[model samples]
Target chain A: MSNKVLPLLMMPEGKEGKVSRINADRGLLRRLIEMGFTENVSVKIIRSVKGSLIVGVNGCRYILSKDIAMKIMVTFW
Target chain B: MTNNSIRVALAGNPNVGKTTIFNALTGAKQHVGNWPGVTVEKKTGSKKYNGYEIQFVDLPGTYSLTAYSIDEVIARDYIVEEKPDVVVHIVDATNLERNLYLTTQLMELGARIVIALNMSDLAENRGDKIDTKKMEKFLEIPVVKTVATKGIGIDQLLDTVIKEAKKGPHHEHMIGYGDDIEEKINQMENILEGDITLSKKYPSRWLSVKLLEGDDEALKKIEGSPVLDQVKNILSTINKEEYEAVMADKRYEAIDVIVPQVASRHDEKMTASDMIDRVFTHKYFGIPIFFALMWAAFELTFTFSVPFMDILDSAFAWLAGALADNVKPDWFGSLLGDGIVGGVGFVLVFIPPIFILFLLLAILEDSGYLARAAFIMDRLMTKIGLHGRSFVPMLMGFGCNVPAIMATRTIEDKNDRLTTILVNPFMSCGARLPVYVLFAGAFFGRQAGTVIFSIYVLGIVAAILTAKLLRSTLLKGDPAPFIMELPPYRVPTAKAATIHMWQRGSMYLKKAGTVILLGAIMIWTLATFPWGVEYGSEDSYAGKLGKVLEPLVAPLGFDWRIAVALLFGFVAKEIVIGALGVLYGLGEDAEEANISDSVEADPKIFALNSLGLMVFTLLYMPCIATVGIIKKETGSWKWMLFAIAYGIILAWTAAFLIFQVGSGLGYD
Candidate 1:
């Protein structure tokens, strides 16, 4: 485990990280938060295809586009 | 307001089996409609529980009651406006922490809620010990463990609803935002109280919270208020976006503390669902597998419906023959035979295909593979500037465009939905297939299959380029964010899937029947008029109309008859071949084989002309029924006319290019 923060797109597949911050337009940001991407919550990259990834958070799997995955800042440990 | 009846609303995140429970409770007596002015579905039913008549409503499946999307706005508005006596919040016990987040928002809205702990069986199977007593005690809401798929605990749920309705709602579990935001919320609430009409309409505290979160609808409600300036002054100091984050964080934080106390879990382990997803959404094989499955669905839909369609075709043909033979007046017989029977028969022929297609889609949706399908195809769809949700509607355009346009409501972004709607007609709906088969089989002979396939590919290209053009020009913006929830897979139950299929499939019949039936009669009337002249002859009204447009189509090497048939294509694309048959003085409902020979025999029609006509048909405007749906869904006549105009212009340009290029190459 190490204290390194990077975009969720950069998180290696099959590893867990904590969501550090989500930078997006107001509507998308609220949606992201409602989907359980709040600060300090654990998120796992379950799979990646091309640039988009399947994120595992709060006992659910969400397929996020590359643009959205880039906006989410995750802290890997 | 009545003591003898209780109104209960069902609310939940998508894929919590909320619909399964809804179907279980409502049975076949459900009324399906759209929320006023929007396309989101609103369904209501009634059941008798404990000597009280209980009315139930199924709200759109959404994670929160925020105004970010239409579904969220509709759900929250229904709660705030209609004020159902009890809202049954269906929660997946396996993911109580996240599901409970919605529960907290429901608390804020100040509605009476009964928590149905759905899928509790799955949670127990995965080695989670859930203490329902503690959960009920903490949330102050009754908890009923329901396995919606198996129809378990439904009576208990209904019984709890009645009891809760009788006792009245308690919003006792209000979340405490930390001091700074709480003080601001209080200040806003005090200012909001100054507006009597507005405060009486919605909860002041809820309004304050929404205003502080930068909700557009909430901000609109405060317009022209005496305290508007004061509220704006308070809002001006803080970034509402940051406050939104903190408020949502507080809601989840409250759930976090309660979840730990109410449910303890063993370390998370890989489940069968994860294993299946690993294979289904795998990068290398995922796209190929999706195409394979989509091919299978299309094959099953078309092939299985053929026998039933043949039966309807023969049945209608016999009925028309009998009607003509038995009737006394000659003209009256034609009306019954050609107008009434033929008109209704056209609509019925599409029923089998529509029903079967909807059934397969519903089963896929219920099995949770639709989201995975969208996931694998997202990258390709993005290249065209459309959201992944747009793919379902685009693929459905092959079956028919009327229902396909209706399916665009799934897209949350206005620009994306409108763009998808505008381009859908070019996908070459099933109604247009007979036209392609007629043209290709007449001109290309042994290469007919290749030519027909090329026309379909051309349609795909047209749809792609049209969507790209619209995004870059009129509806310019990025595609909607492709954030989707992938629920754990379940073997869809037959009862639930059938109910789902019937609900969606039946709506298509109702919508298409009106325009097709009326348009059929109109085309029949046009061809039948000017009684002294030969029916549909050059001296007849139909021929006069064709003559009126012949010059417009002359550059494409088409005469009056071809122009008239093209004119009739707007009624429904399938009628184009039949219309041509009549223009050639054959049976109005002539068989495709007979029509193919006649079209080829006409000396004016050449291979190049036939090829160009096929391209024109492929790119033309949607059927009249689809045009109506476009207006209804987009809620404007301007967009509908835009869709019609752009389609014709593009069709003309493409056909002109093909004609000029093919001629210069000296193939024709």
Candidate 2:
């Protein structure tokens, strides 16, 4: 079934998402992928604070602001 | 390149304990300098193991070897161009999946790799088992378990490096890019081979793959190639972004296959680091906790450093007096007592504070609180249009601006880094602290701590306003995107903290010996000249020159002597105290007279003027060392000049307000 896909920032805390699309320029896109944000990688939103996110992807946690989080589109189950 | 001397390059992602491993292997035997034509620090150290002298080159930590950032370009360039005998890819064992991404790129670079499964103990402690043997077998590389902080597996790591060097350069288990991308890579490899020099310098397949993926640095490598026209045709036909995506996917696919077989976490419970982060980054308490910790850090740094500084001052005073008694000429006695010993002593006193500050910074950093601090503080930073990465460097600026400016290299954007550098000196470095400590102690008495704390607060306020002003004007642009890895917090060990502290703190010592020494002598010569004139009297060159500059600073309540002291302070802020000591006639009374007492005894000085002086010194041009580094890092005299001019203008205006307003309010 086709599930809802939303910006990573909009995902509920504790929900895991499959990173479907990354809306960033070339440099940032490459950085995203390098950090294991490639397509279909499972990204877990561990916490949301102050319009930023604490995300766990591939066993590593990263803190990112809403600006970057918004650029990342992820699929919810 | 020497017989029985192996050259090994250390590569890894940031926060992977790579530096700890390097420090363990090298152990104070390292030298840090910039990579040629780039400001990124290149650290090299040699260690003797197994009758082989192995030289280790510590590369900038990078997640990938792409040309998106200067760090990546520098790391990749060194690996491909230098062609080291062996490359030690230090993988954080607990985060193997995230780290092995770099491994795939290293493999593509065609370097003989030995994996240092670093922090294996941490992984095991977390209930994650990393099978080194299985990891090695699958990746076709030797994997050594290392807990670098404890000095574990260091010899094994060196042995593995030696063994790998002897076996020669070979990259096995290259990721297959599937049919479509592999065809493009093969096509470019054929084209690249025509340029023998290019093919010889870079792995043809790697270069070809990079070119197909639209790597900027890789594209520049084929600038004047014979196959340029044909390569352009092929690049035009391919979707570079898609190729980039697919190739990256393939690399991850390759890693996904191996990491699972080798390592798996047994427990799904929230990690201790996670629990700490939850508390540390909590909505209401996060910011207050951050401020409290910072307050504690500064409190501990200043409290512990003061007594050590006093003891050092007396020790130097005794040495200067002993040397003066033995020296030949009367002027020479003054030189030994006041010029050399006094100047170096003043500068050296700042070192305890610098060391203590960096020690605290290291504890914060190694515990991973710095990254969280950056995270928690990012919104406030971004409000001023400063990047999140700017927070670390600015915090470091409180220790010393020279290394703090150097720390701005992490800001991937050039303009943002430049902005960080320009506003950094306003952070009131350790060298500036001595000035405030002296003035505030003499003026505010029991309230001296509050006064000193206020100066720091004012400097931070100045920095924020300057950054806000900058982002709207000359550096006009959005701040770089804010995303940072928040590494797991670990209990900081004393040894690791000390190593981290000395890594940057020693810059203070070097300045004390070199730049500040020369400055001290220059100030001495200026004050001593015009024969028969009293040392630092009105008839001397320093006094005459200070008189010429007096009008400019008169509005801020500074006299000629204070003017001259500030002029010398431009060499390094620590010299402000030394210059004042000489001008106060403490030159002759080395052991008997105290500089702070001299200030307290002055007829023209009091609390308001002292506060004004502190404000002025806080915002003035960066020290000579910091100026040189700013120029080097920005690679622009234009920006350096702008920073110098902006600081002076800002200093004068701010101090003018403090002086005029404090007097207006009848504070004095």
Candidate 3:
């Protein structure tokens, strides 16, 4: 399945939680690794203001532009 | 004396949370300003701890110490000349190997070094362990783990810094290289050591390595000194071109050794970020995803802002009526109700839409996706001969043109900077948001969202076409190659993101009080007239001015009243709405009428007219402040005037065509 439609963060209350493993192709995998995304690292959904999800990776948070986030596949672990 | 305060400098790569850590340590004591004679920001702060006044200077973030850019030059100069009490080198723990490359360079600078292993929480969570003790032992500096965001390990980090500051420079520590390169470095260092001045400040071995790397800044620094000629003679003997290749090889060799010992990783399974990036960065899907997100942003801007805008409009109208009822004289009431309140109120109604627009933009920026958008759009940007780096500033233009033009500092090439600055005004700025919202809301109903979205797209297209034309003719040059480090994907902090949004939104509010206020008052005076006759009447002063210019804009179907609105728009575009409000004798309260209904009832206010106005706004001469900034940045009044004249001519021609063709299609 295409990873773009994956629901990566399951924020029932929209609080911080551990990030789930992603299922996608090799090219995406390599790019993510380069961007400091790896398995077992906790990701926090800080806020979903204006339909864009602001997630914190490691300790530093980056607002993920909405367009890029729609493609990452995941389910709340 | 122990009473003497020590100066410490914090340096790191961009997006490493260095600023957060700086704010955490210093709190309210910090002062922020630009570096001397340069636009790069400088931050300095001090805190008293354990009887020692620890002064901290936050140098601009840079990837390396090589003077390839202004920030790097500033960082290197501060360290080498000022000789800080201790240099705290902050590195991202998650990307230890890449971060340490800078660490090796810092050590070579011969300063008292302390490595802050920031973001330890993430490192621990990822199942990757960094043995701080081993790292300290191998690198020969104190290693302190810190999560700057949560204020973790900060005290310990400060304590280590204090201890290191007392010890002064670490002369014994040197990053080792292999025999071949080491032999070359030793020969050069020895040759330069005898020149007394060369050995006084800089480390000989570090100077030798930099000389070999063909760093021009370093070459210039050591130039004119007798020792430089000797170094040059040695370089010529060794073949200068090959010297750089050999030094690069040496850097890699050192990296090869330092990375494995100080860093270890657990091979993790595929993470969600990786999986998501795959399809998002895909050749076919990425562009479509970008369009979809932008579409959502447009939809939200129009749909969500309506209710708030309506409430604000009503509140202002009610206030205007109450003032009109209580005021004594007729002219006084007109000035209060029609002039001040009407003009300012017309512009004030757009606050809701501007706020919503900023919120959406902040969300996008805070999220790490904006960079990826730039990454995806790079090819298209290149095809039009504009650097992808131009995207960030242009994106910023959507917030405000002033800062967007200021952001041109990041674009290194002069020609690229000029082109980006010239075309930036075409991007639908926050000021123009109200004009579009007011017109589109009045004319299109629910379709207003799509209408606003199409206007933004139109602005972008005009900007691209203008950039291409300028490049081919006036600003001819090959666009600089696009190269940028894509930061890791993380959720942005609510505190930071909100602060960013408010800061941008507040600028608009401030402008309303200052420039827009003066503009509205002036427009009111022009529309007010000779003797007691309202200036808006066909026989008044404003009428004469508008009639004289009306023929010029007649092709776009604008009457004298519309011509007056366009005239005021040149002073500040927000006044376009206010000028229209006053001209129509719509007391401050009258502007609250449903715009969509008014446009529908009067077919003359066609979609074509709206489209033409949007195009004209996108292409017209920028607001007064932008013109001042253009003069300052370009340092020439000739170019500034050229920008103004060219913009107005282009705007008129484009608006004329859009209206003529669109009306031909029976859009009215």
Candidate 4:
């Protein structure tokens, strides 16, 4: 495990990481948590192209635009 | 059997085939109306099985019971206040972990739960094995595997629901919220116990847990309670968001403990869905593929439905002629032949194209492609300063703008919702589609399909440009965050698709039977009055009104006749073509071909005027119902009037420009 944290958009394709923090407005953060993006939740980037990432979280795939992905900070383990 | 009458609710995350199960259970016994105040649909259906009468309420599909969205608030209130006998929780089998979050919340509410593991076949096809028996044991709930599309295991699910309902109320189905939160929850529950009014209104334990999590809806419910100040003081001691996050995490922890015991997967495999996404959502190819598919749909909607439309037109025309010839009184004959038959028949002929378009859209929506469309188009939507969630409502506008305006309630941002609602009418609903097809067929001839497709494209372009303009000028702000689930693509079932298509298509028929029927008779009465003047002639009332409006539209190359049709069009877009039918003196017995010939013979309407007319039709003030809804949804007569005024001004200017520019290029 590394202490380094980066925005979810920076995570390379096919890499798995855990959400460390959500740097967004209260409304968006609440929504992110509701969608299974809680802190320490493991997320695997299934595909990343053109700034949007298709990530696998909690056994479900979610297509996140760069705007949302950028607000999510994660740590790779 | 005690002849028990049970009330059940079907609840789940969106896109989990929950609606399919509801449809299967209720069949044709469903009645859909709006929720009391909100525009969200309330669906209730009943079924009698083996001496038991079961009434099922279909709750809105929600991600969680949080107060973040209207759907969530509505669903939460329904379960808390209505207290259904049994809640059949539908979960996507392949996505158990995330779906279980809702399941955990339901458990906290002490809901008597039966889990319908929907899409089991899809999960198995993805090489994920789900042990329902193990799942049932782990969660202390009945689990029934169901393939909703194929209608498998539905009876067993219902039987389990009936059994659960018969067992009175659930007493103990709580999920542990770890030590720290459990301590706080207990404290809150103790405080809540003193407030008998609150306890009687809500399940005390659930209220306590939600209050600790700082749930707004729950807090609002207990606002006047004696324990409110105490609970607020306690909640202030801890960070509200952190508590919410922690509670959510604890729920996930419960699911994490159950997952390994009940399910296994052979690694992560690239599914056929992923393969399709690779191409369809490709960075460069995605937009082109989307437009190409839209073009194909437009072509099919126009080309394939032509023969059916012709048959209907001929049948109605023959009936009108028979009535005109056989009836005794000429005015009575004219009322049957010209007023009723002409008005209704003229609009009814457009049904095939409307039905085909809705059917194609339903297929696209059910097969999961529409979500992908939204996902891929998010960038462009954000560029226009609108949320991607606005896309679905705009798509619905293609069916009708009234519902589309109401659908904007899903948009969380106020500015985004207002802007989306204002621009929704420009999406060229099916009611407007017939005007395009009629004009394009009359003038464009061999290129009618292309002309019609281009009109749709023009509509999209206008909607986008208007949105950008509104964003820059009136509705200023960034769009809400775009987060959407790209559901797995499944083959849309014919039964489900047909049912959806029929439901939407029938709305059009219902409108025709009621509103359009009245409009036609009114127009007929006006056109045929002052008995000496020929019907729809310049001396008649409708004709005189058209003459008055003719000067306003003349610059756009339209005459009094088209101007009068435009006036009638404000009532309903579909009536534009019908109005034109009456104004052209084609009568009810004229086929589509005859109407086209009539328009073709009129020198006042040529290629340029037709183009201008189509543009005006596309951009003009939305039909009356849309205006009413805009007022209702925006809660302002000011914005509604603004929408109407701006649309009319924009339509006139754009049509004038198109006509003037095209005439200079000598298009006619």
Candidate 5:
């Protein structure tokens, strides 16, 4: 079963895999959507330092707070 | 062709990469400086394209030409007074509807307009298509699609510009208001038309509309004119303070008509931008994300730059030793090796980390994320009595306090601007990076990165707290209402980001070479005074000065040497490291020399002294450049003195408390 929400920070360590198919929660999720991160869009984790991660989603890289990353659930494909 | 040298004005909303297009149009041929009578920057450049010597004037970006803000006033004044042959209104394609709002206002300015649709790639990727032919036909001007940074469709843009400029300014095809407003505008225009000076310069209808809107500058223009009393009587009869509201309503009415016809909606699903904005600005997650992102940036600055810094440190150390060995003992040797190279090298070693930090900030800014960061912080900023707009300038302060202080022009209120300028020094500018890196490296090991990160956080906290205290007392006023435009996210170009990083990084180097060099020389003199007993010793001039000041700083756990360094740091904080290097008798090149063995052999000797020194450095007075900028910007010496006095007192008190408490807890 695919997770309901994929924490953006915990996406696999490498850049080759598909992002988990999960809905972002409200507020932050809405903000993310407004900034062009939508459902089914593939994202790649570019760099992870300590707990925080910088992810490439829809051709732009976004720095994700580590705490926000924990709530996002993803399915590895 | 000489007579055909068409003057073109490039006008646009902020952050649409209009500057990028300006750079592309006139490579290596641009002059940038402050606009006269105000601090708003004026950038002019020239390019010869298609037999036309296109002199492009980049107007300050504005949302509308309503004359409510300085930028609007400047933009409107240039369009009316300078009378450019063609005005290129660059609009971000992805956010077409909101961008077109400005284009609608531009239509009323009586200048020939051409719309440059920027960021076409983002629009195409999202499957939201713009019918440029339809847009052009509706707006009655030429439309050019451009991705400015990549040089896409630039030749076509220039071709259209030349064609449009050749036709000269448009006499017809102007956007109009409602019949009632148009009638009032005509009446006002008829009365004002006799003034040849105003008639020749400004559009009669535009002036009339501005009069209706209560434009202060426009009012001042006709204030003492013979028609002033008649205009006032007419205004009072209309039962309005000014024509501003009427004009604004008409413009919005025109926008209401134009936007819907030109802009179209696609699939009803959430746009990628909207989805991402949710999480980034979520109430619970927003502040945490901001802090986390900031922490990550600091971590990268402190950690990633270490290897490069080590390389630079070793290279400088090698250069110093080689010069010492090859050159015979003389004044030239000491001056070149110690004064110029050593002093400058101490400052230069910080370039890598600061460069990286700037690179990240440039990316964040270009990606359109910084606006969201500001949006997230607006509520908190209001509570602290600072407008949300103050955050961007303060964030820029982290790179260099000069431009950041200058950026306070964006804040409309005088008090808010002054308050922001006053607290800007507490943001721990790039000049203080060397101080943190030096001591953080010496005492904290790998954890030094975290320690440095906390110092930045502490600086921001202090700034916010200080802003609160000042607002409630000296500059008491309501924070300006938060209103900001969050530009659409785009793939930030590597070239643009690199140029930004270089521009800022080179500025840091320039400051080091000039101000920091003079500061270092002054510090060296102070350290070497009473010429033979050794520099930085208790008998030396700097030491004696510090000794005289020590009693005041005693509570702050600072000795004479630390006090002296703090004093010199007021000239430039980067000089504190050079001052300490000289005082410790650890040659300028000793940053690379591992003094670990000497310190480890005598644990009681304590590198914690250096830690105390770092704390003091972190919290000291604004640097010389910052002080000068504050004086110029605030136009008052009293605030400048207040900044220095309060900063020094706060730094001493914080350092003293940290040292006393830490020592009392036996950590030292």
Candidate 6:
């Protein structure tokens, strides 16, 4: 277990990361996991906007806002 | 084959070709209605295959059976209560990892499961191979390959469904939630085993798991139960969120093990969809690109349909004229010509532009770009106290407000749904597009498109402002967080797009025949009565009615005829044009004539007055059908009446300001 986890929103565009943890409300966390943000899943930042990020996780494209992205902690590859 | 019947439910995530499979199964035998209590759409179809009646229900697309949203609740409750004979879980083969998450929940519910490996061709095209046999062995469910769009393997899917329906419910597919949580669930199930009533109503094991997960809807259901206190006492001892997370993780762990064994994936390559998303959803380029595309859609909608509109206009005019000249009795001629032909013909003439607008919209929707439009617009929509999902409904309002209001059902947050519904009518629908074209054509002449476009922009601005006002006042809440999947763009098929276009367009034509036709005839009857005086003269019923309301609208520079048309527009916005045709004695052929000339002949309708009228039309009450749905959706007359009253005040104030300011600036 690496201690190098950071919020996914802070990861630079085009960088790949593995989801390590999620710090969000129960409902949002459940939604995020069902959307394939589960722990140990590989996620790549396809695009990052000012307050949102488009991430590719498990062959699906999701547009997640800053608040949602910040809650998803990941370790950069 | 015996005369046996099978009830099957289709469940899947959005964009997983569930609808296509439903269409493939049922073909033309499908019907859509609301779920028993909620407004979420319920689609059901029946087919006779092999001498058996197979009824299919398309459950709302949801990621999980958790009751986080209304759609999820409906899907969950239907499966739990209705107890469908078999639930065919449709999984997108290309995106198996995410789609299978829903499958885990369906399995937990103890449903008789048959997995339809939809879009297998797409997976193969992307250079991935899915071994259905290994997958079936792992999940203990029958797997059937299906390409629903092309109808390949559909018969095999149905045959599998029939076979699966005969097998009783199975609960062997449960994901192990480790030891501590599993212990608690067993304890809760043991306690529930004492209560005969609760066990009969629900799967006791599933209930205990959900109870440990702190599902609010599940907790609420056990309120009056004798075992509720014991259930709560047990639930209070466990940490809910941690257990829920562990449960979710275990499900994913199961999928993680199963996915690799069943399918081998090549390292994901950047595909064309990624390239398109790179530019289309680029932070700096997205907004401008979205607006540019919308502008092109509007331009195409208007310009492409002009010649067709002219053809319709002339054809209807000829019909009216031929009837009026050839009819035996003069009164019958007027009734047939002016009353029916003039009223209904005026409403029908605008069908071309409205139909084209819907066609273009259907293409955008089916091509999957509409979701991206919502994504891009989300940033701006949030400023006005809404999220991306609200934008879809507002965009649909451009077609017609009825379906748009219904579209708000997709917005999970109640306040968001209400605000979206309240502001939807402000998004200048195609019905109102003709009114703008008529006025802008009559007044602004050479710059008609620009004027019409400006009116549309103003509608958007009004909707935004109304949303802002609603958020700050009655429906007070911060904008809900926006999270949505952007499906890869697919080349929209002409057949699917045409079916969608005609499906929506037919609603407009239906409104023309029912609501609009009745309104037109009613207005014609009002204008033609007291049967002796010159038709449409001030002494006629409609004329007198307009004159009585004239003082109320005079401050906005509207004349009696304009006032009367606005009144009739309450029925349906298209009726505004039709009412104007009737009011000025221009007959059914008003659109074919230079309607601009007759409007210009009226001393009261100048450039400024027409501008005022357009602004007024943009903000005023939604049509009768829209108001009815608003009442029905909100389930409250208070909100419905409030919507109507506020729209009137808003319309008057906006129009008055424009007319007054324009006059002071010497524009008129």
Best by TM-score: 4
Candidate 2 Cα errors over 4 Å, as ranges: A1-3, B171-173, B225-230, B265-269, B322-326, B412-415, B445-447, B473-477, B585-595, B629-638
Of 2 and 3, the candidate ranking higher by DockQ: 2
Candidate 3's C-alpha lDDT? 0.72
**Backbone clashes per model, in order?**
1, 0, 19, 0, 38, 0
DockQ order of candidates, top first: 1, 6, 2, 4, 3, 5
The C-alpha lDDT values of all candidates are 0.79, 0.82, 0.72, 0.83, 0.72, 0.82
> Measured with DockQ on alpha carbons, how good is candidate 2?
0.61
Could you give candidate 5's per-residue lDDT for residues B157-249 as a string of tens digits?
899888888786665435576787678778888888877777777777777877776667888878667777777766766744334444444
> What is residue A42's positional error in candidate 1, in angstroms?
2.0
- Interface RMSD, candidates in the order listed: 1.7, 2.0, 10.6, 2.2, 11.8, 1.8
- Which candidate's DockQ is highest? 1
lDDT of 3 by residue, B45-93 (tens): 9988888899999988876777567888999888887889888888898
Question: What is the iRMSD of the candidate numbered 5?
Answer: 11.8
Chain A (alone) TM-scores for all candidate structures: 0.93, 0.94, 0.58, 0.92, 0.69, 0.90
Supply DockQ values for each candidate. Answer: 0.69, 0.61, 0.03, 0.57, 0.03, 0.68
Tens-digit lDDT string for candidate 2 (B1-668): 46899999999999898888898998889899989886677899999887899899999999998887788899989999999999999998878777999999899899999899888887888788888889888888899999988899998888878877888767554699999887888888888888888788889988888888889888898888887888899999999988988888889899888877988854334678888888998878888997777667666666777788778766776666666566778889878776787667766765776788778878988888878877777778888887566878888888778778888877787778888888888888878877877777567756665566677778778888888888888888887776778888888888889977887778778877887788888888888898888887779999899999999999999999899989889988888877876666455454354444555688788888888899899998888888999888888999889889988998899889989998898887
State the DockQ, from 0 to 1, for candidate 6.
0.68
lDDT of 1 by residue, B1-668 (tens): 38688888999998898989998998988998878887666899988767888889999998888876788888988888888899999999888877888999888888999999999998898888899999999888889999999999999998888878887645444789999998998999888888898888788888888998888899987888898999999999999988887888788888889988999954435677888999998888888887667556655665666567667756765665566456768666665665556555544655776677668877887898877877877777788788666766876776678767877876778899998888888877766766665566567866665576577668867887888888888889888676888889999999998997787667546644665556556666776887866555677787789889988777776778788878878877766655554444324454432323446778888899788899888887877888999988898999999888988888888777777888789966
What is the C-alpha lDDT profile of model 4 across B19-118, one tens digit per residue?
Answer: 8999899997888898898889888999988778999999999988887788888887888888888999999998887798899888877778999999
**Residue pairs in candidate 4 whose N, alpha carbon or C atoms collide under 3 angstroms:** none
Residue B238 error, candidate 6, Å? 4.0
Candidate 5: how close is chain B to the reference, as a TM-score? 0.89
- For model 6, what is the C-alpha lDDT against the true structure? 0.82
- Give me the chain B TM-score of candidate 4: 0.95
The alpha-carbon deviation from the true structure for residue B191 of candidate 5, after best TM-score superposition, in angstroms, is 4.2
Evaluate model 2: give its TM-score: 0.94
Estimate, for each residue in A1-77, the C-alpha lDDT of model 5 and write its tens digit. Answer: 55434466555554433444435443344334333344444556544544435455534445454444564555454
